[model samples]
Target: MLIDWFTVGAQALNFLILVWLMKRFLYKPILHAIDEREKRIVAELANADAKKAEAQKESNEFQHKNEEFDQQRAALLSKATDEAKAERQRLLDEARKAAVALSFKRQETLRNDAHNLNQAIRRKTQQEVFAIARKALMDLAATSLEERMSEVFTRRLREMDDTIKEGLADALKTASDPVLVRSAFDLPAEQRTAIQNAINETFSAEIHVRFETAPDLISGIELTTNGQKVAWSIADYLTSMEKGVDEILKEKDKPIAKDEPKPEEPKPETKS
Candidate 1:
């Protein structure tokens, strides 16, 4: 092998030039394209990671907000339920109170009506009983009773005041005819004679005597003259008793009026 330094050197120089040109053109351009692609890939990866992190954070926040909404809705439903229960209870209490008041009023009205009805029935029963008893006693005393009653009548006439005798005398003298004397029972001959003598002693006249019996007078004597009747009777006494009973019933009907004092009955006249 003969050494060719010049040729070898020239060839080596040519190769070095080619390598420099390739490095300046193709190799440098390709390396720069690769570097730009790597940079773009890295930037894309960073953008994707940031988007994933943001999505995760948003998901967590959404879940937390959903929980809060659910809690609020539950609380609202519970509050509404409680309010409804309270309202129902209040209405029930009001209804019960109204019912109690209405019941009390009804009971009061019934009591008053019952009391009034009882009073009316009692009064009607008393009146009927008294009437029946009076009728029974009067029927029992209708007959031989009249004979025994004459002595009692004579004593009552004599017990009358002297003014009564004087009035009888004056009335008999003024009479145009014999005065008709009416009585509850037929006057006995002796009693009639006594009455005529008493009258004649005061008036000095012969007065004709006429006697009649009227059962309705009970026990009484009536002297009729000039269409005027001056009479005394057991009927009058019974009338006064009836008036007293009526006053008692009226007082009982009005409680306020009962507080007032009652008037005293007039005293009987003294026959001196």
Candidate 2:
């Protein structure tokens, strides 16, 4: 502890100078190098993170594109399916219409053929009916049938409706000419006298009478005055028979109806 002031001061000054040199030359350079290395590491980390973010963005874009493509594909498939179904339905409808038209045409042809055959049959039947009737009537004595017809005419005149009787009575009263009696055969005096008596009795009045023979009036007798007439004919009776025959033939020839086809169901499409 003996005080040596100069030596102590010199040692203290040298120590301070050595410290300054070490700090300036060694510590400052080391600190600067470490800071630069840290800055470079931080920049590299930031760049890596930016690259990773970009890759993630690219992945997202790819995924979005895939999703869009899938949606478009689905839409296209749906559209195609709808179009195919429409086309198929259209074709089926056309085919069905064609079949219906063909069937209708065939039915029409059959109807035409049936109508022609019916016409021919009807004509032949009418001729046969008339021929048979004429022969049978001819087989009966003409004078006998004509006498019966005259009797029927007198009965019909008596049984006439009130209006027709009144009309005929008025005509007889006003007519300038005598009431005319026509027959298919010449009436005998006795038959003419009977007709004249029957008419006068029916009207409760006396009237002039004339007799005529008409060859065209077959199995018929007619009485006329001032356009009023009363007559009966066998030909009218045969027409009803012809109509009934026509009805029977038409009923038997009607065509049978065919059943329509059912629509087809569409099958489900399988996934690819």
All candidates' lDDT scores? Answer: 0.72, 0.82
Which regions of candidate 1 fall more than 4 Å away from where they truly are? Answer: 1-149, 187-206, 226-230, 255-272
lDDT of 1 by residue, 1-272 (tens): 68799989998999999999999999999999999999999999999999999999999999999999999999999999999999999999999999999999997886677557655654565556545655665677653433334444445555656786667666776778777778987787877777666445545678786788887775677666545445666556556655666577567767964678889999999999
Off by over 4 Å in 2: 1-143, 248-272
Q: For candidate 1, what's the RMSD?
A: 18.1
For every model shown, what is its TM-score relative to the native structure?
A: 0.35, 0.40
The stretch of ten residues in a row with the least summed lDDT in candidate 2 is 253-262
In order, what is each prediction's RMSD in angstroms? 18.1, 16.1
